[model samples]
Target: MITTVRDYLAAHRRAKDAFPGALLLVVSVFASMAGPSGWHGPRAAPVLWTAAACAPLVWRSRAPVLVTVAVASVEVVHLASAPGQPLVPGASLIALYTLASRLPRRRAWVIGLVVTVALTVALAASRSDEVFAAGTLASFDLLVLSVALGDLTRSRRAHLAALSKRAEQAERTRDDEAARRVTAERVRIARDLHDVVAHHITLVNAQAGVAQHLVRTDAEAAYQALGQLKDNSRAALDELRATVGLLRQDDDVSEPRTPAPTLADLDDLAASFVHTGLPVQVTITGALRPAYPSIELAAYRITQEALTNTAKHAGPGATARVHLDYGDTALRVEITDTGNGVRAADMAATDGHGLIGMRERAAAFGGTLTAGPGRGGGFRVVAELPLPQDPGDAR
Candidate 1:
């Protein structure tokens, strides 16, 4: 019984249908009043008629036009029979406003105009003093105002919802852009670290071979190579520290830094590789134009890595040539080693991209790179990187 009552009440609330329900209750009370005390009526069956008239109010919002017609018709009869009574036209007013607010501009206007005219006409014919007068026109104006208010409230709600959705989409777009930038930066650091460290590692490998061979034959050469080993080890560590430290900065807890190596340090690079017992030929063919530091750094790394690869895969009998040709539009690098040819299957092991990290360095500067067996039996790597506008440009 409790559940059934709750459900009935819930359904009633949804329709409120209760507007008509309460009106029915009031009409019943009025009918009882008319019968008991100072009542006089030849048209006796009183309150039931009023209650029946307002029954349609329960579905006013559901069928506004039908509800309006029924209430207006009953009110008309009640006015003709009795001169005075509290005939609440609440149901008609509610229906008229609902139709006007919900329907489109032209439809709402047509419906509202027809209903208003009908109500006025019905009121003029009624014998009741309660018939619509000039004051009723004021009530009609208020019906239109209520309709406009509901429409305005709906429009504002829609506008706010759209703005909220747009803000959420913008935040998602910002997050995606941040993720892309982070990925690009990591690729750049990987390229830089590979270039800077690979060359020094190659030097260590080549010198280790020389010193090992000479330590049993020539004592003087052995002593010199052992010293060179220490220098090479320290140099590699210093370069790694500088490049890595540049990438890792915590302003809250960092010491002052010194300058890092750049293209100007290429002379020292060429000399160190030569000390490793491999003959390297250097050639610069550009018109002496400066490039972006990142681009130049890219160039330095490419050359260094290529030489390192040549020293690793090619035997000591191989001769490596380094070329830096600067064109009007771009800078070019070519490292050719005249050594035994590498098999296609051994590529993953003996190729320049393997240990020297050529492919990664080339990608960092938006450059094109190619590495393969030379025309005869050796190996070659070529890269083309864009140049900066001015000859004095750097960084």
Candidate 2:
């Protein structure tokens, strides 16, 4: 029965208002019957006054000032009609509390003081012999206490509301940050796949053509071309497997079979192009030193993409040169071809995916990449990647 009543009060606002007033009326009526100087006239007068005072409390929250005035006025009349009744009515206290919590501090205090003074004066007047009795003083104290408690409740509610808003903002910020990281990871994976597939597949297609042509003429050269095709295909598969491994969830137990390619693998990279009948000469101008793995990988992929573009678009009889220069602050990688490749105008008009990927990779590492026709003739791709101040910091 208790749980059912509690649920009904929680669900209904009208029930919350009526429950307290109903209980106060019932308790006040019962207590009035036992008082020493109760009901000097008709016994029903004091009961009617008590019921009237408590009834206004049902609208205390809705019209606190009016409700408080009405209740206090009725209590004063009740005290005059019956002298030695309860000094403070419970309904009056409830009304004062509602007024303090819902209104501003200065206004609430002003109104509360006025009501407290009015009730205290009425109580003292009812007891003509004892003007400043213990009951009058105690009634004043209870009224002030109710107002203080109401203001405290209001402050606590405000504090909890502010805390709830802050928590929601923090959760939203975390979700946005997670989404950004996921998008960046997706773009990085796409670039890796593009570089791997484009570079090796171009070689495989060229080698297959060479083998088909040579098989009709020179059997030995055709066998060598076929062998190079097999190697290029295997290399493509290994790099693809490594790039795809990044998609696995954190709980995944599998690991990539091959390590990421770096500048150290440049020789093997150039040899693959050489087998496709393109002459590539790699030149190093400065002292070789360790660099960040990400930096080296970007440089290697940039070089590979540049050379692949040269072989595919640079007319026949094209020879490409790759230069690596390690300096005090940065590492420079440049690829240039002798054959007249796509003109600058045409390259700009097309805006191929390879150039976009290269630029993105360089930008990711706080570096820069520029691609266009070289000074004399042919295509050129130059990427400048910053090196760490201390070589030991390279990872």
What TM-score does prediction 2 earn? 0.87
Off by over 4 Å in 2: 1-7, 33-48, 61-66, 80-84, 104-107, 124-137, 253-255, 341-345, 348-351
* Candidate 1 lDDT over residue span 1-395, tens digit each: 97986678677754565454575557566555664558755343455655666677677667766776777677667656654443445545555656654556566667666766665555545523344566556655665665566456546667888999999999999999999988877766666666656777778877888899999999899889989988999888777776667667566456455355556667777788788866788888969677887777777777787677777677768888888888988888888888776643475654434433566666766778887888877888888888877666654
| Number of residue pairs clashing in candidate 1, backbone atoms closer than 3 angstroms, sequence gap of 3 or more or interchain | 1
TM-score versus the correct structure, for each prediction: 0.67, 0.87
How displaced is residue 56 in candidate 2, in Å?
A: 3.4
| Most TM-score-accurate candidate | 2
Tens-digit lDDT track of model 2 for 245-328: 888888999965798788989998898899987899999988788889989999999999888888788877899999999999
Candidate 1 global TM-score: 0.67
Tell me how candidate 1 scores on lDDT: 0.69
The superposed Cα distance between candidate 1 and the true structure at residue 290, in angstroms, equals: 0.7
Q: Which of the numbered candidates is closest to the native, going by highest lDDT?
A: 2
